[model samples]
Structures are given as structure tokens and as C-alpha cells.
Target chain A: MNEVMSLLKNHRSIRKYSDRPVGREQVEEIVAAAQMASSSSNVQAYSVIAVTEQAGKDKLAELCGNQGYISECPVFLVWCADLSRLKAAAERHLPAGAETYESSVENFIVATVDAALAAQNGAVAAESMGLGIVYIGGIRNRSQEVAELLSLPQLVYPVFGMCVGYPDQEPGLRPRLPLEAVLHWEGYDAERSESGVKAYDETMVKYLRERTGGMKDTPWSVLMAEKLAQPARLHMREFLQRRGFGLK
Target chain B: MNEVMSLLKNHRSIRKYSDRPVGREQVEEIVAAAQMASSSSNVQAYSVIAVTEQAGKDKLAELCGNQGYISECPVFLVWCADLSRLKAAAERHLPAGAETYESSVENFIVATVDAALAAQNGAVAAESMGLGIVYIGGIRNRSQEVAELLSLPQLVYPVFGMCVGYPDQEPGLRPRLPLEAVLHWEGYDAERSESGVKAYDETMVKYLRERTGGMKDTPWSVLMAEKLAQPARLHMREFLQRRGFGLK
Candidate 1:
């Protein structure tokens, strides 16, 4: 593999950070790269808020499930799925008496996908600079508080948060489901996927035993099963609606 | 900028492809890179279908609103937001009578975000090796037929398609919204975003006029307003629910 491929395949989320500061210029460059990701019809319905201050980071860290790295990391970027700009654009330029702009599930998907794509680009750029990062989905645990803290307007919601800094700890790459499990040819193959999962369960059981010194050895299926049975962020639908998204 | 940042900033959708072929080895490498992208709680709730057969490509092209590049490209990849694997995992190990797994809008967002993050990584990997790519959101235009064609199981929905090959045309990089439009400090600044959009309107007007030889000289806001006012893929909500998603 080439350098880029090597870098990509070596990815491991870093939850610990060093004190080396990330300069503003680097953040700008990262955002520049992020702005270049593909958007649905150039809507580019996404925005990022970088929190570097102690109070802001502390509040964010507390809100995001008390993840200390969120405060320790030089940057905590809140990536948002934003359509407020599109609404502004529509209000400004839509022909008089034209159909009104309203957020639909389609727009919701478009904005969310756009946010993820751009954020991924930003993640890759950070890694390329020898900086490590981890995504904080706990950003959604209290979506209302996060929004209020960030002063987000209607049609704009924080999709996720990311912590970026030099690595203070080394972590092993978490294995993924085999390629056959996720990559299908022409069409999906159920049997192949089942077989892949069976094989991956064994791999995970062994990997966990080694990683956790046999303290947390369990098949991958067991963990996923537990996760699936529990409801996560149940307020997401209501919150999204409250934020003026997916109301169609 | 470094190599990766340079590449990311230089991205442009390639809608034309040369006659060169993409090998399975390259596809595996790309997928390997993709698998390394971050997933929320390591759910990795996404899958990919590679369509190389002429018939499959032709059908997908037709289904994707007749984007000729999808059929013409040497490799077309359909990326899916999948929860079926988690369902299967739940069935396999969930303490028998535990609450059954059901897809929710939260899962919907997680899966969609997972697919996009992986796809962006794959896009970057492909670009690193001297290939070009364009995302085809038109994949959602007729979700039912496309899903049937791919034999997607419940809880698996095509998020987007990507066409990859050697570039036959060198399209200029499409300028994005100014960084100031999307990047904020600590919190969102609507005033800055508005100003940025106003400045970008002038830039886009010149770009559109130049690109279209003095024709189609509308500002960015006008185009976005029209897009927002129109109903796009209105069936997405129904289609997703049918696919066993967003039903919580």
C-alpha cells in the first residue's frame, strides 16, 4: 500500500492527548479540506464550531458524558448538519410566491450525509498531520443543551463532536467485520454475510481476550445484541423535530 | 498543504472516465481504507455493493436518473446504510427474550453517518491512487427498484453510489462556501455565515458565467433557493420505513 493507504488503514481513535497545541492555521487548512467534500447539489449544508477555550471545553466535556479528552484535546470541533443557510438563501432568492422552503426528511438526510462526509475529510486531514482524533457521539446525549451552548439556530443541529490533538497514548486498531461481510458483488449475499459474521465473532472473542487480558472476552455478536436491545438517544426524533428538521 | 490536504482540496467530481479498468485488488485496498473510518460505538453499520457487470451498471444508471458515468465507469460502488447485521447479531445472542432490535431514526442517523464516513475514506483512497470519483445521490431517487435490484435485506438502504475510474476529463475544482461561512469559534455565528454567503454569491456568479459561456448566470443563493423550494425525493421517508429503518 502507498503512504496514504497506510495512513488510512492504521487509523485508531485516540482518546488521550498531549499538550502540544494545534495552531489556528492548521485548523483553517483542515476546514479548507473539509469544505471540499462532495455535497448534494452543492448545498454544503454543514458547519463546524471549534471550541478551544477552557470553559467551553469543560462544559462540552461534561455534556459529552464526561469525556476528559474532550477538554484536554487542543480542539473540540462540533460538526453540525446546517440548513439555516439554505433557508436564508431561499428567503432571499426564491421567486415571489414560489413554493416555501421547509425541511423534509430528504433534506435531513442530505444535510446529515453532507456533515459526515465533510467531517470525515477533516478527520483524515488531521491524521495526515500526525494529529490523532476521536468522534464524540455523546454529543447527542443532550442535544438540546449542546445546541444551546453552541448558539445554533433553527435548521442547524450538532451531528457529532470530535477531539483533535497529538496522541498521548497508543491504541491498537480495532478490527472490523471481514470485507466479505460488508462488500457484496452485484448484490447482497445473505449466506456470505452470515458466514462472515460467524468468523468475525471468533476473531473478536480472541482479540478482546488479548486486549483486555481475558477480563472482557466476549463474541462480537453478544455486544451488538445487547446494544441493539437497548434504546439509544430516544429523544433524537423529538429533538430533531424541535430543531426544525425532518418535519415534512 | 501536505499531500493529503492538497489532494482533498483539489477534489472535483469526475463525470467522465477513460477506458481503463479497475482491478479487484484495488477495490479491496480501497475497502480496507474505508473500513478504517470511525464508526459510532464501533457499530460499523454500513455495506457496499460493487457492480461491474454491464447489465447491472446499465440498470443502476437508469435507476440513478441516467447518469451515464455510472454505467461508463469501470467500477460503480453502491454504499448502503445497513442495520441488518446488527439485527442478525441481536438474534444470535440477545438473552433470548431481551427486547428485540428495531430500527429507529437514531439508528437511521448512525447508519447514514457510518456509510458516509466510510465512503469518504474510500473516495480519498481512490483519489490517492490517481483515480477520480463522483458521488451519485440520485441513487435515492427510486429507492425501491434500486434496492430490489441489489437484493438488499430489511434494514439496509442505499445511501449513495460512487463511480470510479481514470479521469477522461479534468474538471476544474468547484469552489465551496468560504471557510468563514461554515467554521465558527466556540459557537455558531449567523451574522458571519450571512456575510460569507453574500460574498460567495458574487464569486459563484462569475464562476457560473465563465463555466457556461455567459449563460446560466444565477447566483448560488438562487439555485439553492430553487432546490429548497422543490420537493426532492419526497418518498425517502416512506422508502426508509419500508426498508425497516426510522420506525421507532
Candidate 2:
């Protein structure tokens, strides 16, 4: 494989960071790379908040379920699904008779996906520059509080966060479902998928045991079930509604 | 910038493609790169169905609002937010007393974002190999029919489709919003964002006029207002509910 392909295939999430700081020039290049990712209809419906100060990072870390890495990293970035800018642009450029659009789940999905695509590019760029990075989905646990902390406006929601710095620890690549289970030819194949899952469960049991150093012997399926069994306790649906999204 | 960063920044949606057929080896490499993308909790809750058959692509083209490119591309990949394998895995691995998990909007969001992040890598990988790609969001326009055609099971919804092949058209790098507007320092900047939007509207007006050969002289903001004024007419919300998602 080529260098770019090699960089992508050797991906791993970085949770532990060293004291070394990430320079602004590096962050700039990373964000510029993010901006270059595809946007739906050129809407570019997303914004990023970069936090470098210790106090701000501490508060954000607290809001994001006390992920200490957020505070320790040289920079913490909150990727937001943003439609507020679109609304502002509409109000400024549209004629008097032009219809004002209300946010729908569709629009929300577009923004969320746009943010994700961009954030992934940012992650790839960070890793290419030899920086460690981890995505902080826990920010969604208190989405409202995060929005308040970041002074986010209506039609904007913090979807996820990230930590970037030099790596202090080397982590092994996490195992994923086998490609057979995840790749279908032309259509979904229930029988082929069932077999794939059976083989994968066994593979995962051994893999998890090795990765956790014999501490957690749980099966992947059970863990997923436990994690997702309860409806998200956080008020994400209401939170988005309050932010003027999902109105349709 | 490094080669990866350059590869990312030079992205442009390729609509027209030559008669060149993407080899299976190339597709495998792209998918492998996609699988290397980070997943939330390593759940890896997504699948990709590859379609190269012309008849299959034709039906999918009709279902996706008659996007001719879907049928024209050498490879059309349907990326799905999948939880069915998890369901089956949970049944097999969970303890007798373990509660059964139900799909929710939260789970759907995770899968959607996961699928998007992977698809972006696939796109990047494809571009690195001298191929081109364009994402198709219109698949959601007829989600039910698509599910039926693809034989998608419950808890597995098609998030979006992608067309990949050698480029026959050289589209310019589309203009994006000014970085000042999208990148906030620690918090959202209302005044700076307002100024950025004004400047961007002017840039977009000029861009759109030139791109459309002066036939469409509309500003970006005006077009956004017009396009999103009507709520997504498709019954995606109801469709997801029927498919056993959005329970929360």
C-alpha cells in the first residue's frame, strides 16, 4: 500500500497523552485538512471549538464525564453539528418572500454526518503528524451543558469532542467485526452474516481477553447489549428539540 | 502539507466517470482502509453492501431519485447503519437474565456517524488510488423501497450510498465557508461569524454564477433557504420507526 493508505490502515485511538504541547501550526494544518472534506450540498453545516486553556478544558472534561485526557491534552476540540450559520446566512441573503426553513431531523442528520466526516479527517491528519488523538463521545452525555459551556447558539449542538497531543502510551489496534459480517454482495445476506457473527464472537472473546490483560472477560455482544440496553439516559432528544432541531 | 493532507485537501466530487471498471482488489483495499477507522466502543455497528451489477444499480438509481451516476459508476456502495448482528450476538452471548436491547435514536446516530466516518475513509482511499467518488444522500428519499430491494433486515438502515470509479470530469474544488466562521476559539463568536457569513455569501454568488455558466446567479444563502424551506418530504422518521429504530 501507498503511504496514505498505510497511514489510514494503521489507525488506533490514543487515550493517553504526554506533556508535550501541539503547536498552533499543526492544529491549523489539521483543521484545514478537515475543512477540505466533503460537505452535503456545500452547506458545510458544522463548527469546531478549540480549547487550550486549562480551566476551560477542566470544565469541559467535567462536563464530558470527567475524561481527564481532555484536560491533559494540549488541545481539546468539540465538533458541533451547526445549522445556526445557515439560518443566519439565509436571513441575510434571502428575499422578503423567501421561506424561512425550520430545522428537521433530516437537516440534523446532514449536519451530524458532515461534522463526523470532517472530524475523521482531522483525526487522520493528527495521526499522520504523529500526534495522539481520541474521540470523546461522552460529551453527548450532557449535550445541553456542553452547549452552554461553549456558548453554542440555537440550531447548533455539540456532537462529539477530541483530545490531541503527543502520545504517552502505545495502544494496540482494537479488533472489529470481520469483513464478511460487515460486507454484503449487492444485498443483505442473513445466513452469511449469521455464520460470520458466530466465528467473530469466538475471535472477539480471545482478543478481548488479551487486550484487557485478563481483567475484563466479557463478550463483545454482551458489552454492546449492556451499553445500549437502556435508552440513553441523557435527554438528547429533548436537548436537540430545545436547540431548535428535529422540529419537523 | 504531507501527502495525506494534500490528498484530503484536493477532494472534489466526481460526477462523470470513464468506462473503466474498478478492480475487486482496489475495492478490497478501500474497504480495508474503511474498516481501520475508529468505531465507538469498538461496536463497529455498520455494514457496506457493494453493487456492481448494472441491473441492481439501475433499480437503486430509481429508488435514489433517479441519480444517473449511481448506475454509471463502476462501483456503488450502500453503507448501512447496522445493529442486527449485535442483536443476534447479544442473544447468543448475554446471560439468561440479560435484558434485551432495543434500538433508539442514540444507537441510530452512533451507527450513522460510524458509517459516515468509514465511508469518508473509503472515499479518501479511493482518491489515493486515482479513483473518484460522490456520496448519495438521496437514498433516504425512498428508504423503504431501498430496504425492500436490498433485502435489508430490521435494525439495519441504509444511511447513504456512494459511487466510485475513475474520473471523467474534472470538477473544481468547491468553495467552503471562511475558516474564521467555522473555527471558534474556546467559544462561539457571534460578530466574527456574522462578518464571515457576509463575505462568504459574496464569494458564493460569484462562484455559483461562474460554475453554472451564468445561468444560475443565486447566492449560496438563497439556495440553501430555497432547498431546505420545505421539510424533507420523505417519511424517513416513520420509516426508521417501522424498521425498529428511533424508539427513544
Best by lDDT: 1
| Residue A46, model 1, lDDT | 95
Task: Report the error of model 2 at residue A88, Å.
Answer: 1.9
Clashing pairs in 1: none
Q: Tens digits of per-residue lDDT for model 1 on B1-248?
A: 67888888899999999898999988888888999999998888999999999999999999999988888999999999989999998877875588864667788889999999999999999999999999999999999999999999999999999999999999887889999999999899999999999989999999988999998788998889989998888888888888888546
User: What TM-score does the predicted chain A of each candidate obtain versus native chain A?
Assistant: 0.97, 0.95
Best by DockQ: 1
TM-score per candidate: 0.98, 0.96
lDDT of 1 by residue, A1-248 (tens): 67788889999999999889999988988888999999999999999999999999999999988999988999999999999999988888875787754568888989999999999999999999999999999999899999999999999998999999999999998999999998999999988988999999999999999999999887888888888999888888899999988546
Q: How well does candidate 1 score on lDDT at residue B160?
A: 95
Per-residue CA lDDT of model 2 for A1-248, tens digit only, reads 89999989888888888878888778778888899888888888899999998999999999888888898899999999998878876676665776665556678788999999999999988988999788888889888888888899999988889999999998877776777878888899988887777677788889878888878677666777677655563477778889988635
Judged by lDDT against the true structure, how good is candidate 1? 0.91
Error of 2 at A141 (Å): 1.0
Residues B141-208, model 2: lDDT tens digits: 89999999999999998988999999999998887778887888889887887787778889988887
